[model samples]
Target chain A: MSIADNIETESDIGLSRTGKQREFAGSLAMPHDYFVLLKPRVMSLVVFTAFVGLIMAPGNIHPFIALVAISAIAVGAGAAGALNMWYDADIDAIMSRTSNRPIPAGIVAPVSALTFGIFMAFMSVMILGVLVNWLSASLLAFTIFFYVIVYSHWLKRSTPQNIVIGGAAGAFPPVIGWVAVTNSIGIESIILFAIIFVWTPPHFWSLALFRSDDYKKAGIPMMPIVAGNRSTQNQIFGYSIALAIVGVLPWVLGFGGITYAMVSVVFGMAFVYFAFGVLRMSPSDDEMKPAKKLFVFSIIYLFALFATLLGEALWTILL
Target chain B: MDNIVIKVTRVEDERIELNDKQKKARRARNIAIALLLGLLVVVFYFVTVLKFGPVVLERTL
Candidate 1:
């Protein structure tokens, strides 16, 4: 059954027939439901990248300031996730993969999510501006706006290249972190941004290939939905190649040390190999195992790459 | 359909009203969250004050 029909049936099981009553029922959401709105997993990655940026910058910030900056960035990322969930509730309700989300599951009222998200967004940006640097604050503001307005509202349903352009919003954290420390943007920060921006297409497309049905049901113009599986696979392979190069650029450019270089080369090759596997798989393969493998490996690849960078930075400081 | 609707509404109302124990636990949790949020605000304020020193305090005055 369609998601709307499912929600209707589900809500009717324990609530009144009218929409208003269903909303009222949802208003009694628990604290955990509110936490789910923050998208904790995504916030962790944002916090890590921003921390790396802060540490890797030329100078040091006071520990308290660094903590505050990172916290603000984390809150900002969570705010964006909440806003995305708020705006995409309709599509989210339809998609099997997203059907259990707080809004669609009748755990939280949509209006509450919207108001909470807006309030958090304003709070984070103001804290970053007043307590930290305005440059980072402005970047954080733009990131939230771009993610909510440009990507979620405009590009998601309208274009297959939604992720390609929208990826910039995620890529801004490290740059914001760098600005938080130095009050300026540098080549190193831009390279960090480039790594993530280039990494996004391949990373997200792999999942899209595996879950194309979800996007189709949700009417989202994901790469695999608009373009055929073959086209998506080919594009994944192409972006993987670009990501491999960009992933290694830090080591090659002398910013990263031997440890990072080794890690990058190994993981970059593995990424390409996974993408190649996806490309070679037959379209009729029901499991889409290769795409799933690539999707899982992509997450590991990003974490390992950043962890290596952080380790190298710490190593330099200690030695 | 009418009977089902009535039954569902009753269940929803019961779900919304927490038992005494659940209410106590929820209240405690809310208090903890409020304290944590307050601590964060205090830290931010002090850090701002430390960074800007007398300038911030003077501006407030």
Candidate 2:
């Protein structure tokens, strides 16, 4: 339900601009504010992962269909993000990191955002189902449902493992992309899903370490707030080990070539090293450098792993 | 559009006119929506053509 799905992009969705307005007389909301509701940064990652999954799947697809598929997937993710902002407006206002989000900033009304989210969600899923395959569309729908219902609405406040579970919503893009191409699931796409899924807890827990105050203020049960910093650090370390193992699975399973193997092992080690840094943090340090480092590096780590996979696949295809 | 535009009806009523900021914001949003709609039209056309080929337009009434 949150990862910032809790990583970044507290960016939320907006009115079609033609819709009814009330928050401000004449509705001062800019189109950009509406666009922010879509969570563009998060959408970028979803698009990239889904694009890679589509490309890596074992089939040829019409380029237009693939384009539509990716667009739909991205829009669907955005729709979910909009719903998240709509649902989390109260807490969002409390958290400094998210307070300026369009809804909280009074740039967009919550009902308008809700309307925009529902409309886009319906449109994206229907377009994908019609232009692409039902399987992918179903996956997209489920991703939105899981994020909006399971994560944002339910788990986000109820449990420390909110992201551990909600991360599935983020991980589904690639699988949806792969299914958009194959019209079926495959272990390769599953591996891509696994990488993101396993990568999420540590990625977010690092953020939770520093932003615990925000969560505390908002009453969101992020790992650090719920489980305590020490337990969260240990869990991050444990997940780091799991992440390293899972990161290398593509290579182990042989879909990834030597280049991917190298990227995975190197970045994977760096990930663990960072996590271990967080694990070894001292109370004397005024700032949580290790957690911050791990947080920043984790974004790079996931991107590098996925990029290598995308690059290797493209290389294989082009050559 | 001004934030508060006075529309002279038979009764001389005033319609809401956006301020400078709202006018610019509305213009920007309209342009964005127009662009997205234009893109959607193009995408749907291509998808129809690609999916159905030359036969896309061959349907009977």
Candidate 3:
């Protein structure tokens, strides 16, 4: 039987037919379901960071090879996303924030998701290995394994530090992209990874601030759910400060140009301001406006930082 | 916020009928898979049997 078979109409639990249909509609969205599995918003960030990494590396890579490498990394990232959704299907079903996901919606079966993830992981790594350098391929493989086994299977739900440690999986894309071009790890890639690693907690904590109830209901140990809102906010502030400091490292390291430095400093200041907002807001404040604002701005901040890096690198090379 | 709760009562087994769009998607997916498998076979042939190797020596020095 498919995973969808386990999903019952509300009538099985004795609800009215229309009510059951409504619930089914909410849970079992089909057709365009695979797109949802990709976590497209997350994919966008991964793709951008990986692109920057590829462009900023010292050596010249063939355009076609770079294209293939980036595509492989994107597939690998998507595979990780699919595996995460598969493993979290049960919790996803219970959380209002995630109940509309493909698996929980009964649009895709759990086993199917598992198969798709494994297939994509192998295809991605293999393609990278054959067409790109082995170093990049190995890194991509490790990233997939870390995301699926270490983070999804083990760390998440087991600890509130899940985002902190699991963030490594997301941070590796740029490094992998860098290695794809230069065939070697560099200080620049390490600095990029560090910025993302520190940036994750504040980004996710802001999300948790607003979605704590969903996490509480799902029995997940997100920071805001495990600790109080105040503690989570404090953690967000600390991580934001760390992220800002790290964001400036690429500029100071001579890997970035003056434009990048100026943009990074400005974005870092904005990040700190948002972080302070999270810290100062009352827990009883309706809608968790500060947390939501910080979450939105955090995304733009990362994109701007990477974009600025790319711009500066191009400028330096051309001028 | 008043949360609305809805339910589904399966008329038959918990099987959902795939709509026309889903059918088209399945067909497209099958074609893509077949093409990929074919490409893999050709790549394997070129790499292992034909030994169509990289011209690194020509490029290096």
Highest lDDT against the true fold, candidate: 2
Task: lDDT winner between 1 and 2, please give it.
Answer: 2
Query: Best-fitting candidate, measured by TM-score?
Result: 2
Please tell me which predicted candidate would have the highest DockQ against the true structure.
2
lDDT of 3 by residue, A110-168 (tens): 77677778898899999899878899999999999999999999999899999999999
Candidates by lDDT, descending order: 2, 1, 3
**Chain B TM-scores of the candidates:** 0.65, 0.64, 0.56
- Report the C-alpha lDDT of model 2 over A119-205, residue by residue, as the tens digit: 999999999999999999999999999999999999998999899999999999999999998999999999999999999999999
- Local accuracy of candidate 1 as per-residue lDDT tens digits, B1-61: 2223321222344345556655664665577579868987798778967798788757532
**Candidate 1 chain A weakest ten by summed lDDT:** A1-10
Model 2 regions lying over 4 Å from their true place: A1-21, A283-285, B1-17, B57-61
lDDT digits (tens) for residues A1-319 of candidate 1: 3333323223435443455543544355667777789999999999999998888888878888999999999999999999999999999999998889999987777887898899989999999998898999999999999999999999999999999999999999999999999999999999999999999998899899889999998889898888889999999999999999999999988888899999999999999999999999997778999999999999999899889888988888888
Measured with C-alpha atoms, the lDDT of residue A43 in candidate 1 is 94
Please tell me what DockQ candidate 2 reaches.
0.18
Model 1, stretches more than 4 Å misplaced? A1-26, B1-33, B52-61
Per-candidate TM-scores read 0.85, 0.88, 0.81
**How is the predicted docking of candidate 1 categorized under the CAPRI scheme?**
incorrect
Range of the 10 consecutive residues with the lowest summed lDDT in candidate 2 chain A: A9-18
